[model samples]
Target chain A: MKRVKKWAAAITVFITGFIFLIPFYIMFYLSLSSPGDSIAEEWFPRALMVQNFREAWEKASMGRAMVNSLVITVGAVLLLVFCAACGGYGAARVKNKINRMIFYIMVLSMMVPGIINTVPLYIMMRRINGINTYWGMIMLLACQSLPFSVFLYESFIRTMNSSLEEAAIMDGCTRFEAFWRIVFPLLKPITATVVIMQGVGIWNNYAQSVFFLQNQNYHTIPLAISTFFRPMELIIICLPPGRQLVLRLLQWFF
Target chain B: MMAPAAVLFLVFFVLPLCQGVGISMTDWNGFSEEKNFVGFANFIRFFSDKRALHAIQVTVVFGLVSPFLLNVSGLFLALLVDSKRKSRVLLRMIIYLPSIISPLIMGYLWTLILSPRTGVLDQILQRFNPSLSFDWMGVPDKALWLIIMVNVWQFTGGPMMVYLAGLQSIPKDLYESAKIDGAGRMQAFKNITWPLLYPSAKINIFNNIIGSMAVFDIIMAITMGGPGYATESLSIYIYRQSFNGFAGYATAIALIMFLIIAVPIGITMRWMKNKEIEM
Candidate 1:
């Protein structure tokens, strides 16, 4: 009976993993095959070609998009981590009623959707002449992501003991120095988790990029892939029947 | 130090939410020079609109079904791979890979695979059964299901990891004790594992529901609520109303969605808090 259960569990894992991998397998096969070859009955590519990838890279401006995405993600993560670390430390250490009030207000921010502010944020960006700018996009993402960062940091900081701070104080360090020297170092794991979570999220984001940065120069990878479906003269000349159908479906949806 | 973070949240989140509620009560077109308070007329319009109602229903269905299916499947997957198997790490990586792919890219990639004319699925189906041509995105019946399937594929990995963490935390001694007491595998799971996993279940359910409700980019890329309003969700509907020149109506729908999400979330959080205390 135990053996039977183990076999069943193994089979379940295999089946679930296969289902999860199907789309990725299809993507890999399609990316390798020529546009015409992808429509063939063969699941594996008959004639492997790198031309599609090369063309996609150039036409989509993926190289530039990668850099733009990286910059935005890193910038937002830095700002979020720095601010959240300081704020969370303050909230944990400071005993004032004002600090408690501030902490609750930050927690409330997590409930509201960022989309609610889109129109006003757009207008503000325009007034500041920041539309289509990288800084504008970074700042917007930072604002949206700050709430979760502060929440995570605060929870982690509360778990930490205050003896480290006391030791630093006995060593003649100032309060700010004590926090910077004692608390921040211990918070690295939480910061790493925050960076990974928000980094991946910001990197894949499309809405803010599409709405804020209209210029081709500032297009992130998601937005660049979107532009591939736009009116491009090369598409008519190069795309096969199957690829054209895919493009049409995307255009209809978008 | 907390001052800057607090101010940013208030300015961006609290003020905007308050302003949105105000806008929902008014007959504002988002860009008009004149605005007037309509006093719950927008809410009334939201309830009366058939399309909006359909979108709401779709959103609720997706919210419930996708998370339930994903969490169940994820928990099962985690349990399966929890044993000391050589392929466990490989299986885990393969399962989690989809979470890393951008939804827009995934949407585009799936379109290539699901296209009726040249899609791989069509070709495979044709080989086994020649008369199996079906319009996946074009037909209203299959479009929403397809979207749900895509979401499940993308998100199961995250919940699987959470469940894996919970599973690891359960002491092996408990399982050994259950076995010594003549408890079968199923009985042991029922007696020992299930109770211990409740916290993880609560968290996974809450996260998946909230995350799924906010789903926008994938649907925008895949279906756009096509073949009529079959796949229309609240978020998509809100986008249509606001950016698609129905600002007054859109604000109303947004408020309705906010309520729908908030009330259920609040209730669940409260219930989970109680459960946490009991545990």
Candidate 2:
């Protein structure tokens, strides 16, 4: 019975790992398979080809998309970090009702779904002629990402000792100087958490980019990849037999 | 210092939420100048709309299944990697790579793999066993399940990292004590590990649940709630209503979804706070 339980646990772990990996395996295979491989019934690619990556890269305007994604993601992350750092410092040190209210408000802001305001946000963007502009997208992404950033930072701040701030002040540091010089530096671990979490969140975002950025030239990686699906489907509709077999084999192996 | 954050939050977050509510009560077509107060009509329409209701059902199913599976699987992975391991950092990185990719890209990538014909997945299944044939995303019933599978794949990494942090915080002495008491691995896990990991479990479940409830990109990219609305969630329904020209009604649906999620979330927070105290 004990041996059986151990086997069950081991098998569960293995299956979980397999589940995590299967899509990646599929993606590798799909990326390697040629466009004309039309055989619908096989799993492994018979031929290994790098053409799909090249094709996907060029057709998706990957370079420009990467730049756009990077600009938006990095800009948003920096803005969030700066704003949250300041806000977190103020909320941590100030005991006023207003600061408490501000903290709760930030928490509440997180629950508001992005799609709820997307329509008005688009209209607002258009009015400002900010549509498809990197700044506009960055501002929107920053606003959406700020609540969690502030929350994480505020929690970390609450756990910190206040003596550092007192010492900095005794050494003639102003409140702002104390926060910037002492508090901000102390937030490295939490900052790492915030950066990783928000960076990944903003970088991987697609819905906001899709709605706000209509210019084809301003497309992000996600938008570019999405455009590949239909065209690939269209190409698969036209392949001949023997080459199709090669395509199927390519699909399976990669 | 709080002024800037407060102003931004009020303008971008608070006001928009109010506007979202106000928008739901009006008969404003997205681009039109003319508008009228529709009151409860939009809400009435949403509740009665068959397609919208189906989407809500699908969204609820996805929310329930995906969070549970992802959290459990993540905990399992965290436990495996946490126990008696070297190269754990490399293993963690490998597992987390997918979480960094945009869900939209992942969805697009998966659509290719799960394609009915010429998909790598279909080809591989055929190679191993001739009778094992399936169009993973082509069928409506299967499409919803496929979306759930994709979500689990993408999000398990985040929770896994959190769980790893939690596992590392557990003292080595507890396990040693369990072993001295004749406890085997399972016994040690149940007696020592499980009780101590409750806090991590709560946080992981809370984060994933809230996150999963707002799932939009993956569904949009992969199936577009398609093979006929099989994978539609509340967020997708709102997108369809908003962009697809059901403006006020879309806001109404959004409001409903907000309520559905918000009330339960508020309750969960309260419950978890109390549970934390108890622990």
Candidate 3:
């Protein structure tokens, strides 16, 4: 009975895992197929050309795009963490009417769908000369990410012991200084979680990037990959699975 | 301490939202400063627009169905992993692989798979029975269904992770206690696990509601709301309308979309307030 149960569990996991990876399997299969090989015609690669990886890598400008994504992601995450952590801490500890109201408003703002803000945001970005600039994109991404991060930080901080922070404040440290020196350092775990979640989001941002970062030079990986989104175009898109894998791998490391 | 977030929320979020409401009431072409307030005219036009109404239908269907599917599947996977105990690390990673990349990329990747003759899925299905082969995204009837399934497939990892955390936090003693009292597996699960999983359920339900309802990039990448705009979500509708010189109409549509999402969210928040589900 025990043996039967073990085999059943293993097989179930195997099947689920295979289902999860079907897209990836298809991705790798097509990426290696020669240009002459038609995905419509071929079940597998007709000619295995490892050279396609290199060809697609250079063709897609993956390196420059990677750098753009990394810089933007790192900057945005740092800014979001700094601002949201403080906001969350304040919301959790201060408990004043203004702070409470602000917290509620921010939480409520999370439901305002992206499209609502896009038109005005685009106009504003152009007016402020923010289009195609790294800082502008970073600031925008950080703000798009702010409400959730603040909510997370607030809920998380509320669960922690406040007496230590209170003692720090009582010992002549200003509230800000106490939070910075004491509570901020201990936020490492939640900060890491925030960084991973928000970093993936910021790195993979497409909607705003397509609108805000339209310049060819400023395109991130996602924006770069969209070059092949044209109709009747699969081979050009599929061949660049190298960068997509890099995205998943980057996610894995985090 | 609240200064930075307060500033960001006010300037970026609150300000844009206020500007958005103002824009919804106007005739601005989204660029020219010249404008006129035409209150509720755009809103009236939405009921007349067949495509906009279709989008509301699609959005509500997608919104309602995806959360149910994701929550159920996530909990299922979480239980499977929790039962095994030793192999979860790798299993969790493998399951979560779909969610890491941008939905735009996911959409593009699906296009590669679901494309007509030259698509991977079509070729594979052709080999199997030939009759099984069909254009998945081309047909209007199947496209929205495909979008919802893809949405569920992509983000199931997030809910699964949450459920796994909730499952692990559950004390073994509860199960042991139930077993001691001669409860069957179903009874134990119903009486204990289901109630205990409320917090995780609430969070998952909330996230899935928002994520699936606001879905854009994937659908945009996959169908671009195409095959006669059959799969055009509210987000896509707003995008096309705004750029096509109906900026005021689009903002009005956006506000309607907000109300659609807000009602469910308000209900959930109230429910959360009342329950106060204890761990």
Q: Which candidate should be chosen as best, given TM-score against the real structure?
A: 3
Candidate 2 regions off by >4 Å?
A1-19, A35-48, A230-232, A238-254, B178-188, B277-279
Best by DockQ: 3
Q: Tell me how far the alpha carbon of residue A206 in candidate 3 is from the true structure, in angstroms, after superposition.
A: 1.3
Ranking by TM-score: 3, 1, 2
Docking class of 1: acceptable
On residues A23-120, what C-alpha lDDT tens digit does candidate 3 reach at each position? 87767766576656655566677777677656556766867787888888999999999999999999999999999999998888887766678877
Error of 1 at B3 (Å): 2.1
Best candidate, lDDT-wise? 3
Residue A242 displacement (Å), model 3: 9.4
Task: Give the clashing pairs for model 3.
Answer: A40-B118
Question: Worst 10-residue stretch by lDDT in candidate 1 chain B?
Answer: B270-279
* TM-score of the first chain alone, every candidate: 0.88, 0.87, 0.86
Name every residue pair that clashes in candidate 1: none
lDDT of 2 by residue, A1-254 (tens): 99998888667656756766776665555555555543344466667666655544565577787788778888988888888888887787886999989888888767767876876666667778778998888778888888888888888899999998999899999988988888898899989988888888787777788788778888876666566444555655653222222222222222
TM-score of chain B of each: 0.94, 0.93, 0.95
**2 against 3, candidate with superior TM-score:** 3
DockQ of each: 0.44, 0.40, 0.59
lDDT of 1 at B203: 77
